[model samples]
Target chain A: MSEPRNVKNLKDRINRIEDILASVAAGDMDARIETEIEDDLSGIEAAIDLLIDDLTDELRQREKMQKELETKLKEIQEQQRTIVQQQEDLLELSSPVSKVWDNILILPVIGTLDSQRTQIMMENLLQKIVDTGCTISILDITGVPTVDTQVANHLLKTVTSARLLGAECIISGISPAIAQTIVHLGIDLSTIRTKATLQDAMIYAMKQNKRSDEMKVLSRNALSDEKED
Target chain B: MLELAPDRNFELLGEYAIETEYDIVMARQTVRQFAKKAGMGIVDQTRITTAVSELFRNMYNYAGGGKVLIERGDVESHDALIITCIDHGPGIENLELAMSDGYTSGMGMGYGLPGTKRLVDRFEIQSKINEGTTVRIMKWK
Candidate 1:
């Protein structure tokens, strides 16, 4: 009778183990083999629980790392966007178009000349020409260290674009090195008026402005005289 | 004939598009930062950035678009910064003439390629007419 009882106890423990395993296999990570019986099956039950615990820890760690990576990516993107914005701001500040005379616009280009800055300079000059109806624009490059082929081409484009708006563009402050580079590059700026200094460019613009003003005055006087007649 | 060393480590610092003028500016800024990391002086940084600007502008104007790669490596026992510019534009018909100081394709002053070569310590160019052009320049610290 005692042997039969022991066999029945072993069978019950085996059944419990099978049920716990089935639950675990169905994706229930929390399922465990709960048994107070200190028997041969206890070791197997303890090992299964330890495996689940390890798996859970690893999953949690992986999730944490994923979140950290996402945050880092966002930060990098934000930094990139800020840098782009700052560059745009710098370009805007570097190229400033101001109306120095009633009919003259002056754009002082300091530092280095790049394609992007040249584009901004062109845009600013064109917009100012439209706004103030200025007929003459002087691009002062006294502070520019050098000019390359591409920059020279951009300058040509800017001058041509200004002409399209019915304004004459004059580039001033041709450093000797820049002049040599231009000549060596075989760029023909013969059609575009250039000055040796900003002062000279300013004087030329002022003279043109005065002449236009005189023409307007003469025309107004003529109209008044005809009215009187 | 110049080759990157097999044993040397090559790390990509950044890649930029030579699409718009703004892209050129961004490339210059990035190159400046990279040059600084290589422990270059302010003047060297400016030179490298200027070279990059010219190359990027060339790519934009000639090819309509291209790419610039900035990398850091150990070359010939010295720490080096490498800039590679690739463009799929009309390749140079005469490599010698293109490298000359006064030759231009009628768009610019024609000092771009030669001036860039003067700025860097190492310069190499590979091109095929109607296919594209690649320029590799390196500065050492």
Candidate 2:
């Protein structure tokens, strides 16, 4: 009779373990072998629960690391984008074209001159010429330390481009070193009008503006006199 | 023969490649940082950065592409910042003509090389017709 009773207890414990495993297989990570029977099978059940806990912890850790990696990547990309934007802004700030007078535009270029900046300077000067219908543009380079052959050429191109838009471009603030470099490079600035200082350039531009205004008035008066005649 | 002195305590500040216009801009910014770190004033920083910009542009335009290495170290008795530009492009055939102003194979103002030379305290260039060109410049503080 005792043998039968012990066998019945063993059978009950086995059924409980099977039920717990079935629940675990069905995706219930919370399922555990809760039978209090202190037998050899209990040790196997404890081991299975420990393995599930370890797997769950590992998966959580992997997920957290993946999130951290994604965040770091996003930060790096954002920083790169910001750097690009700042570069563009710096270029724009370095070359500023403004209308200082009624028919005069002034672009005070400071710092070093690069091809890209020169291109931007050219575009800005040309656009200002069109927008303001200004007849004269002055490029002031008082703060510019040096001009290489390429930058000088870009200046020439900018002047020519402005001329095509029916505006005259005058470059001012020619440092002695720059003048020497220009001559050494064999750049012919003879065709272009240059000034020694920004003030000189401004004076010249203003004088031209006044002269044009006076000419317009004179021509209008002459037409009136012709009509009367 | 073009290697930096092994005895000098030199550190690589930054490095960049000249492949496009954007890369030129990046090179300028990098040079600016290095110039600042070397305690160069704003004007000197601008000059160095401008030189770098022109060199990088030349590398991209003439060489098709090249690399620039920025280094800082004590050379001789002076603390200097060194910039090295290397290009695997058609080397200059006539070194003298190339060094002259207004000499360009392209429709450029031909101020790239000579202008770069003037901007730095020390400048050296080596080239072979079919091999490549290397330009090294140093600005001392």
Candidate 3:
């Protein structure tokens, strides 16, 4: 006895459904049974196609969102780099070192002093001192609002480092408040030369230059006399 | 905390909230201006300003943030500038030890509080272990 034709047709439809599912699972979304027959098998085929469509839509949406997030992160990183560059420019502008006179480099500190500023100021001053071989450098702190212990310590370090380079650092423009504060803080700034005003520092620097010049002349003359002898 | 004597009437001048380093500088400048306006001489003005600046530093260092209150009052027929600092941070465990010269938590010369006291006419400190610390310092003209 042969099997019924309807049962054989049903078996063939189920095998088709398995082949469609395998293709879909293998990442082939286009493998759909576009069945036109009006039966239970057709309904299952339609449901499988709908499920694949929804999954494809969701995946596309997620990919788009991931791209947008990547773009946003890159934008943030770019902004941060710009901000860092601008900050460096500002720092450079804040501590301006100029050769105001012969053998004198003047650095007018015009804002609040912090560790970073101090570090930069020290580097700039030291490098200028080496480049110019200037014996007298004036650090004008007239615009500085305060000189706390921390700032004082930083300034002291700057002065010490400048001295090591054979340059005498004159700290001028000591505000009344700062002077009193420094003294009250019990910080020993006696080692560093300080002045009441920039003009005073200038005068002191000129005198120092003149005296050194005279000493050089005297030494040269003595050397010549020794050579003559 | 050492407080202003209630008997002497005080005039509120200005109040400053010290939360950042810049705020401390502004406070010192403002307090100096206030002291000068209250008929304090240059030396006295500087002394008061320095004291307040030190107090602000202490507050910023230990308390994270604090408030500075400036008041003017008459003492012995002269002008007195009163400054009060209040902070809500870890309080000092030992007031007497903190007041001692060269006795620090071993940071340095330990002159933070003692040196400030020397710069002012009257100094008072009040603290609670977990509560906070309040310091009052006055300079008379």
| Interface RMSD (Cα, Å) for model 2 | 4.7
CA deviation > 4 Å runs, candidate 2? A1-35, A64-100, A107-121, A140-148, A172-191, A194-200, A217-229, B1-16, B29-49, B71-81, B139-141
Q: Evaluated with DockQ, which candidate comes out highest?
A: 2
Query: Ten-residue segment with the worst summed lDDT in candidate 2 chain B?
Result: B1-10
- Please provide, for model 3 over B1-141, each residue's C-alpha lDDT reduced to its tens digit, 9 standing for 90 to 100: 433345478888888899997798898989989877878777777677767877898888888989888888876776788898999888899999988766766333466788789889888888888778989888887
TM-score of chain B of 2: 0.91
Number of colliding residue pairs in each model = 0, 0, 0
Interface RMSD per candidate:
5.0, 4.7, 2.9
Per-residue C-alpha lDDT of model 1 across residues A1-229, encoded as one tens digit per residue: 1232222376776786677778867867787665555667778868877887887788789999999999999999999999999988998998889998788999999977765677788888899999999899999988875465566777889999999999999999987656654554456789899999999999999999899999999999999999999
Two-chain complex of model 3, DockQ on C-alpha atoms against the true structure: 0.25
Better of 1 and 3 by lDDT: 3
> All models, DockQ values?
0.23, 0.29, 0.25
Error of 3 at A205 (Å): 1.7
Q: Rank the candidates by DockQ, best first.
A: 2, 3, 1
- Model 1, runs deviating above 4 Å: A1-8, A11-15, A18-22, A71-100, A108-124, A140-146, A172-191, A194-204, A214-229, B1-91, B96-141
Compute each candidate's TM-score over C-alphas: 0.61, 0.71, 0.65
Candidate scoring better on DockQ of 1 and 2: 2
Docking class of 1: incorrect
Least accurate 10 contiguous residues by lDDT in model 3 chain A: A1-10
Q: TM-score of the B chain in model 1?
A: 0.92
lDDT of 1 at A148: 58
